[model samples]
Target: MSPRKSVAEALSTRAAILERSVAIASAEGLEGLTIGRLAGELGMSKSGVLGHFGSKETLQLAVLDRAGEIFRAEVWEPARPAAPGLARLRVLCEAWISYLERGVFPGGCFFVAAAHEFDGRPGPVRDAVEARFDAWRGRLRKEAGRAVDAGELPGGTDPDQVAFELLGAVMALNHALQLHHDPRAPELARRTVQARLGRPAAVTGQVHRDPPEPTTAPER
Candidate 1:
């Protein structure tokens, strides 16, 4: 094959590996990933699979990165167009719940699984997992702070506290889903978040209402 074609094929193969790796890691922890299994599943030789990522740790890290991309696409991107503050935050919460309900990761939330798997292990893998969660919570806190500044939330409201509550609800959702296989878990999570956030700020141009007639019917 020409050099360009070879490079294209290599990229394609790498993409395939990451795709499979994310799904496997989601359901079975990152440790479950192995060259032999991936090669057998993808019909590639062990060397070919290993060639894409030189080491198991490297492959695990790559899987975390790929899973983060998928998370952004499925959850974050959908909420991007909403007006910031409570409106955007509400959209984000909804999208996040839907992402889990839709099984984007096959094992529920990839980061959640990763966090549980690596929360204690002290290593690069654990650091990567922690970083992902930190970014998510940071975004939540930023939006909550925006809501406060915009007067959508009470002035005394703590953005980090809000982030913690929201994260707790979704974390419970993942637990219910993976443990009890509860069908109502998503609905419960949505309600919990909505109650905590209260009413979302109405988006301008989202609805139209006719002008109200005068109480005294004007001069008629």
Candidate 2:
């Protein structure tokens, strides 16, 4: 039997391969990322591709995981420094659109492509994708909760509903952008979300502030 790869080495190689797989998927859609293409791109044999992932399904799952990591780095982690609340929620909504606009996937968003590909399929690939969905939705809800706490949004704002709307808007823009290379659809979505939930608020028990008076110059 061939010698076993060390744990550390195996992990490192897997990471590299997963990263490369995403780049291929981003360029050619997940369907385009075949063992042959990956092998050629990575300068490895088809057998080597099989070594990291014994099957295409397994490779798909690994790609999703690595893609999630990329998403976190590009969007989620950056939002952490923003104070939690409607502002954070607003920032997150914009950030997601920006990520799509930035074109992490040359083909468009990976999650968007995978969701359509696996919509009706029941398997580890779908399961893995759903796991990431749950995480994203959860983050939205948590961010919404902060908005409500800070009075940036209506006290009655439903975090789940808010998150859903935001996510749906992103999807709408994603399709629009993919079709026409226009950015407005998603930007509109983000603006709508912020307009709905974000604003300067009076203190919990204080009266609303009036508009500021215009300043006048006595001498020119």
Top TM-score hit: 1
TM-score of each: 0.91, 0.80
Runs in model 1 deviating more than 4 A are 201-203, 206-220
Error of 1 at 13 (Å): 0.4
- lDDT, candidates in the order shown: 0.83, 0.71
- Return the clash pairs for model 1, or none: none
Please provide, for model 1 over 17-59, each residue's C-alpha lDDT reduced to its tens digit, 9 standing for 90 to 100.
9999988998999999999999999999999999999999999
How well does candidate 1 match the true structure in TM-score terms? 0.91
